[model samples]
Target chain A: MAKDNLLGGSLWDAYSNKVTTLMNNPQHQGEITEEEAAAHGNKLIVADFGAESCGDAVRLYWEINPETDVIENAKFKSFGCGTAIASSDVMTELCMGKTVDEAVKITNIDVEKALRDDPDTPAVPPQKMHCSVMAYDVIKKAAGLYKGVDAESFEEDIIVCECARVSLSTLQEVIRLNDLKTIEEITDYTKAGGFCKSCIKPGGHEEREYYLVDILADTRRQMDEEKMAAAADASMTGDFENMTLVQQIKAIDAVIDESVRQFLVMDGGNMEVIDIKNSDDNIDVYIRYLGACNGCASSTTGTLYAIESTLKEKLSQKIRVLPI
Target chain B: MQVYMDNNATTMTDPKVVEAMLPFFSERYGNPNSLHKFGTSVHLPLSKAIDQVYKGINASDGDDIVFTSCATEANNWVLQSVWIDNVLNSDKNHILTTEVEHPSILSTCKFLEEQGMKVTYLPVNDQGIVEAHTVRSFITDKTALVSIMWANNETGMIFPIQEIGEICKEKGVLFHTDGVQAVGKIPVDMQSVHVDFMSMSAHKFHGPKGIGALYIRDSQPLTPLFHGGEQMGGRRSGTLNVPGIIGMGRALELATENIEATMALIRSKRDRLEDALLEMLDDVMVVGERDNRTPNTILISVRGVEGEGMLWDLNNALIGASTGSACASEDLEANTVMLAIGADNELAHTGIRLSLSRFTTDEEVDYVIEAFTAAVKRLRAISSSYAKVGPSPGGEAQACDLLYHHDNDIVVKH
Candidate 1:
């Protein structure tokens, strides 16, 4: 079956084997017949949905048992690329035997995950993620028809590619997973820019709400920030010898300025960390008084207690703030 | 069981060209520049290959043809070298070209622009055709070259190269046409057209890939893009791909010899397919059909159906087609040619470019007509947007067009 790939060679290998099989012979991609529905004595629900950006549409057919409110049979027809057909086929398979209530809970990610040949690998590239999403939406559309609700009630994520209906979290996860560097790579993996291409950037075919370039860049920036913050936390909480002078100062200064500075400022008083000293009994932070607190009495009592407690709670429990 | 109609992407290498190339791999395989007879004996065929290219394009002198790896290299050679030396040396670094040229030319223009060369990408009319006068108006003393394609790859629209050439000469500006898609498929009189530089690829004319030729009219002293041993008369240098050159020569000869017969066969089939499709489908655009575009290429845009979905259905029906140029990235972009003509993104996205060759048969053509029609019908049936002509009546033909059938008369439009 692999050898029969009409579009041959390493180029066609981008599509998974399950995807190819389903695309070539979509087993569940036909409308259920009226006679078959009548014989089964089921109430049939048909739902049609079209993506706004790409104009790719799909029709979902469900034959539900009126007595049990269970979807007895499910079928679909997709008006999109091979990925869409394959996705709809799998979405139909996953809908089988689920009660109307249970089937509505199925999501696009669930549809995509079900097509994976292995659990660890992606079922489809990021560009094709929307096909599974479209597949997932059609089910909601059908369920909505059954329950007399709008299809939008089922969607809960911010869609990034309006044309493909690809959401932000899905794009972020894919960029992270595949290490997608460019908008073109994102388009290849997710089909986000495959249609109108407005999602690639602004001033393309049209205006888009969220472009792939911005999403990829924004997500990458957050990832870098998170990584730097994690590295800082690890070193700050380590043993005294392990903390570099810069890290120790940064840790103390951050805690004092952010947590204790406001209380001191209100009284026309302030303190600065002179040095951090570690002995056998306790770790001590040396501070110098400033402003009105230089000769104040409560500065040594409540003020000192407040500063030491805040530093201990934030940086380390063994820490002390000393006024000299 | 498939009708492969995307000939512009690549062709089935002519069997006769392959036959001529067989001996070169075993018996006559030798470097043309070798001192010994084993290699020197290959010189005669090499000379003949160069001669065939010259004769095919009507080059005034055989020496003007310099074979490169492909048209991309040739295009880069003309635009980049001219900009660096001629355009920059004179402090005149502008290049004039149309928006609808092949990417080989357009992408090279982009690279040149990034390198600080002033470029004007002139727009075309609704027919996807660029006029010579439009090019003339853009040219200045700073104009390095007017690089336009003789014919577009996406819509198969042809530019007025001869008229443009006359204008360039009068303005003292050089002209280079990316004739990769036009040569061998059409008659090219280089001298008469007054083109300063021209690029052609062998693969586009049923020859082997990785072999291309550039023609320099009147032997202009343009700088070389390739530099090595004095191969290609020191203009381009590297060891010649002997087998590929021989194959290109043979393919060009065979394609040129029966050019009229090939044109007739291809044009009739193309016209037949285009006419049948236009007659049947109500919302279809035959891009550049009214223009004097290539006879063998037919671009049809079916309203309401996106390009890749139609291609998927066609692939399912065992038919090969394309929406845009093959040299383009794998992403689904609307044809730039269509865009140049001010086509909205919808029409551009719906374009299906089907180019033919002499090898195409009437049976294959007829089969494609049906297969493509059925694909459009199938996609349009499930498409909710393409045919939103309000419930005008529903039947087998109009069901997908006017209404979609359901098991229980539930024509739900969510």
Candidate 2:
């Protein structure tokens, strides 16, 4: 019979062929008995972990060669959705030949990528992404049990995403390397704040010590400061005093557009350079406030000070920003 | 062998119903409101279809049956119209309903509550059923309406609609029932029930989708859901869905014919399937008493196995089923009926509903029983909670040998 039933199409279609096949007939679905471990002169380790969010649990069994700390055989029993079963299956397979120390290095992304039938398509749907995270956690749990330590001790770095086990340093490094501007781009790169998004902001499933929003904002700010410093060094060689009035106005406008305009625009305000006059020893740049900035109380005090200081720092030391 | 047991969601459209609707789409296609002979010729069959609906529910000529898009629209129309007619115009400002009602009724009541209406959501017992006395105790003189479902879509537990309807009639409050899951599967007599309004969907009983009707007793005064062309006696206004009405009418006619015998066959198959599952699997339970539920439905919860896991295994074997898990739902919230019935949070995610139809065969039921037993065995072996042995000694492992206590039945196996 054809499997073209009305609703059954979408349920199985959400998974790839590899995941579906592994979920049905997982190769390593049994446990490693203590007798079998004794025969091989190995240590038998059983680690059980449960996800409270979806009531899914997994028990990982490992037969590690005691002499070399190498995992000779690994198996898992998963009591969750099909995606979790397939994930645990692949996770156990990936831990087979690696040493106990090397097995701890395996991440959820590696398990999910191994389950993918194609390179581009995801192994499971987005909602089921937490299954691979469960796989990653159970490995840590098994490693922890064998090593006689807490499972969290395996993570040496400051973990930012508990769901994906992504560390703060990894998120920062990925953000800096990719020049990621949005949280979606960060998720695409590191999968931080992807599942159970309590780490993304203040109000989510739980309060977190670190949030992706703050991290992204802080990283972007640092990137901006680095760019400004490099541009300031390059602009120092260009003499503002020898340039014509048009060149002076253009330089001031460039500085304002790069630095001051973003802050003002964020507050629903803007400014335009009207003219630049070289008076006495100071270069006065006349500006007009537009939109919500027109006739504002801060236009003369705080806003004027910020514009003037930014121009002095970025363009030249003698430039004065006057709001006309 | 493809077996479909998710009739509570929707059933395969009956070929006889499809045959009845085919001509109205092309050869007999005519707007009933047109002034020409092509339009006037349709009134005979239209009235026959209306008469068939009236007979399906044992309604009288004095009553009104307004066709709508589906049962959801009919439910919304009844609640919102009562909010306008009774709550806004009169001093009555309260509505009573059960917590286990379909989202259409629950969400509409929620919208009314936001609009300053006092609504009471009565709770169900562990069997997932609402008693009639519960409805009576919540009614006050300020009550405008009492809305309840004739049967639960999840557990198939039939509510006491007759008793609740009698209480509403005595209290002088309007009573409505979402009869979407009850109409063709069971005998619904509007005359004996004292129900003022009832909503039903045709697709639930093998009719084509996108068509349903609302039964209004004595053509009672209520505001219309739509305005414009004066169709449905000005109670609901729009161009009539000619083919949908024809299909629904024929489907209901066939469903009601020899209904007891057909349901008896389906009931035996449902009972056999249920018994086989309970006897074959450990820690598996039916959600409600078989005597209390519709004859063709079973909601079973297998401990240690998630609902989606069972669905995936069964779907692979060419069997279609449904689950009460929020993970399986689009809204991603736990099943409200399971929660309202006081199931433990974990057990609530394990509910899987299988509804049989008259078209379901005995061979299909046997296949499902075998498939379901195999799925339970295969899934439980991998389950962390269904551990048959304790942890190895001195292993420092968190033992997963769990003792599940349910209804004074200790499910502890060494």
TM-score of each prediction: 0.72, 0.78
Candidate 1 lDDT over residue span A6-105, tens digit each: 6543323566778877866778867776667779999777776653234356777789998999999987766566677778888889899999888878
Model 1 misplaced stretches (Cα beyond 4 Å): A1-12, A16-18, A21-55, A59-77, A92-104, A116-126, A138-324, B280-282, B316-318, B325-329, B342-344, B377-382, B385-414
TM-score of 2: 0.78
Residues A1-324 of candidate 2 have per-residue lDDT tens digits of: 355544443645778999989989998898778888889989888877773234577888899999999999988887788888899999999999999999999998899899999989988776566678778988888887788877889878988887777889999899999999999898888878776566888644334689999999999999888866655654566667656566677787788888889988998989898988886689888889998899889999988998899889877888888887
Query: What RMSD does each model have against the real structure?
Result: 10.9, 9.3
Question: By TM-score, how accurate is candidate 1?
Answer: 0.72
- Residue by residue across B1-414, what tens digits does model 2's lDDT show? 999999999999999999999999989898999999889888889989998999999998999999999999999999999999999999999998887899999899889988999888887888898888878888999999999999999999999998998899899989999999999999889999999999999999999999999999998887999998999888889999999999999999999988899888899999999998888888878888888788889999888888888898899899999998655654235677877776565656688899999999999989999998889889888877676433443333433222222222212121
Q: After superposition, how far is residue B130 of candidate 1 from its true place, in Å?
A: 2.1
